[model samples]
Target: MHQVASQLPAEAVASQTRPLLVLENLGKRFGSLQALQDVSLDFRVGEVQCLLGENGAGKSTLCNLIFGVYRPDDGLMRFAGREWVPAGPAEALDSGIAMVHQHFSLVPRMTVVENLMLGQSRGLLQHRAFAAKIRSIAESFGFSLDPEAVVGELSVGERQRAEIVKCLMREPRLLVLDEPTAVLPPDEIGSLLDICRRVADSGRAVILVTHKLAEIAKVADRVAVLRGGRVVAKAEMATADMGALVRAMVGREVKSLDVALSESGAASAPPVSAGDAPRPRALVCDGITVKDRHDAVRLDNFTLEIRAGEIVGLAGVEGNGQSELGMVLAGLQRPAAGRFFIGETELTEAGPAAVTAAGGGIVPEDRHAVACVTAMSVAENMYLNKLDRFTRFGLLRRNALNQAARGLMQEFDVRAAGADVAFSGLSGGNQQKAVLARELTLDPLVALVAAQPTRGLDINAVEAVYRQIRAAARRGVGVLLISSELDELIAVADRIVVLYRGRLVGERPAEPGERAAIGALMSGHGL
Candidate 1:
């Protein structure tokens, strides 16, 4: 058990409305990397404070320090006008601080209520009473989660909601939410922002860690931007504005996505003509069916096609068979019925190796679990899909692998200490870049299934990924882009298709002002 001081220092009890939390010259280091340095910030009650940063800009480090997941190597943190030294998350929670991490920490095999009950009550817990309370919190937060639903059976978005509700059940004075909107639909995003504001209005504080600039103006009273292990900028939402935040985040003026896309004028493959040959279909699926653990039909006879040199967007609310569809396409999960093809060749009941062996690439949604081996070296993970090229007699050629990995890193701008650095050592953005570099460069790679490709990425990183996907399309690869962000689908995909309950319901052109219609189709309104 960890301990915290119960009383505030007499010298610091001067003001009644003091900051709820305060950090002064705090620092943390992970080996050679100074993850955070000389950071000073304040969190006041009755305000939604936003922490803005690039993927590797030490935002997570700061949060961990606050929640007692990690101790500061230097400086101090004062909570409620006291020198707070919470030795662990339990102590932090005891002091009225709760956290919703980016990655879910629920027990998958347990029911939602069961998962939340763990470490909550010291003695015997009345399941019914706890479930009723959970339901109340869920309703207040605009979330609908079945208390008895098993965590593993729920979709990614549903799991996220469960994780959030778990923290909210504590009713803490300070709440930390890390990229909570990454898996939520646009319609739900407004509701979530409202929740943040409501929490603040109740004389509590919310520290929202996010990269989306639009969100700052809506819910945030104050904003802080971090870069290179330091706070580069801080301002009230009304003062500095979005552009200033972006400039501070990336250290330069970045062109907005719309401006960049318009200037590029990226076009799809030319329409087939009477005298011209039909565009080649790079990937095709038909009559695909899938069932969940509870024998529930997730996808029913779902089918789609992607022609060479085209990017097709799959749009829907989260948990609507989007992740499952991507898994099926990547040959990760076997479909209950039907088959798919890559470039005219039938791919019946496949695995990752077989798909990649026959012209397929995949960017999985859960990068840590599916797309990467974090413990391995970055260079080794880069060649994960194509080991034969760097191996002879079942052994890797170290020199050649390093040389090639160096080239790919430079080409993709994968920042790291060295090619030998552990994949986990890199930031989230760099990890995604490394994965893309590996998958996109596969020879004869005609099709790609990118699931939630830019989720949780900063604006600059998102722009970079969009350009890379477009570049792959230009190289005659067909791409099925699965995304929850409607704007992303519209900007990146040439044709947008809707998915509802594992079925394709409708489609629309990737044109401006088409989100509402597509959103409706995704919600199954026209079914």
Candidate 2:
């Protein structure tokens, strides 16, 4: 990819690491779109090589080519110093290459064990024999998962772990992880990076595709950045900092959170002072309790309230019940004991439609799977949650549906060719924007529950999303932002609450120099 002329710099040439995989002038084309161009690189054994790029910058295309998801138009690949060619994913896996895509590939309706054994040539007896090996590999990577757990019943983070475990079961010499930490909390992210180091230290190569610039310094030994389907810069991590990586990917300098989101800016909140009249409560929860598929308590007597125009942030070490709480608010999970209300209207057992009718909205963590229908057009998905409005008796209103979609796309800055484009065709940022436009445009919306809304987004996309959330709060819509980024919580929220073992352990007002205290509370400190 920058800072070099025709070959690698002198410093990189000085390294003695052996290349496990080598690509020479790799190129791939999809119709008129040249998704990848002359992407020549080497992945070395016993090292973590990070691939940094903006969404749609050909990172996925290159990874797909490497893992046999797509055949390269022209190139030469040498794995272990031999010509490498694979017909399909199974061939790649059999040849010691495994990939965990950003979007999961597990069958949600089946248990983890069943999904893992779906395409195997072995019978049930042989498959059951590998269950112990799978569990052992999972535990070795610090992943705790039940082989018999239904994929649909697992949380987003749990599902991610299952997908990773599936790949590790193959014991590949080269492991590719695409945006693995996008849905993980901060602590879990650290652990995942550590596991990557372990993978490399054990004589394997890890190709990490991620949007986070900070992580490269933590785990990567070499870095390559992609821009507009071409490699712009490639260097040892010791020579590249976060700022350099950002400049390489975007070709511009980006501002930090402190400099960009000032106390008096649009992302700011007014001080909590004595008011003239009491503001109306938009969202309230009383003694909510939830359990997992195995009947383990997830949320225990979680009581909270958010007044109109206020933003409350939910912070926790992941799996302490943040996902469960968000589900209860979204009407997807019925709490064991609780009464959730929107403006004094209790909706304890209401479905998603009823909750929407009661002035509530949610941006789920897994947007591709749970939030939007991937096969439908953008116009259809924008109104899929409220199709009744676009239908008259048994007749469909196509014109009206397309018109509404066009309006929302323009108003919310959704980058797409047209309303008829497939929802899955848009980039990750545009997809999230469309989901936001659909959920936040309810006529009488008073509350919004957004879970990890900025995860996996580039810097510009993150800024756009932060502005939208703050704008919603300014419009008197009570907002509950559940995220694992402490700096993000402090930046966008007015108050931050900690959840530990499915209960509120403590809370602190969003203030200067409070990260350490909040982190302590997350670890179950100070009672």
Clashes of each: 0, 5
Highest lDDT: give the candidate number: 1
Error of 1 at 471 (Å): 0.7
lDDT of 1 at 488: 82
Which ten contiguous residues of candidate 2 have the minimum total lDDT?
1-10
Task: List model 2 lDDT by residue over 1-527, tens digit each.
Answer: 22221144444433326798998998887666677788899998678999988766788778888898889998888887788888988889888999988788999999888888877675545656667766886777666788888898777888888888888777789999988888776766777888788777667789999888778889999999998788999989877767778898878887866556563265533544786466789899999999886788989999999988888999887778888888888898899998899877888999888889888988988898679999999998888778789899888798999998999888877766678878876667678888888888876888999998887777766776777777777788888899888888888889999999999999898766888899899988888
Assess each prediction's global lDDT (C-alpha) against the native: 0.84, 0.82
The TM-scores of all predictions, comma-separated, are: 0.92, 0.89
Candidate 2, position 25, lDDT: 90
Candidate 2 residue-pair clash tally:
5
Write out the backbone clash pairs for model 1. Answer: none
* Predicted structure 1: lDDT: 0.84
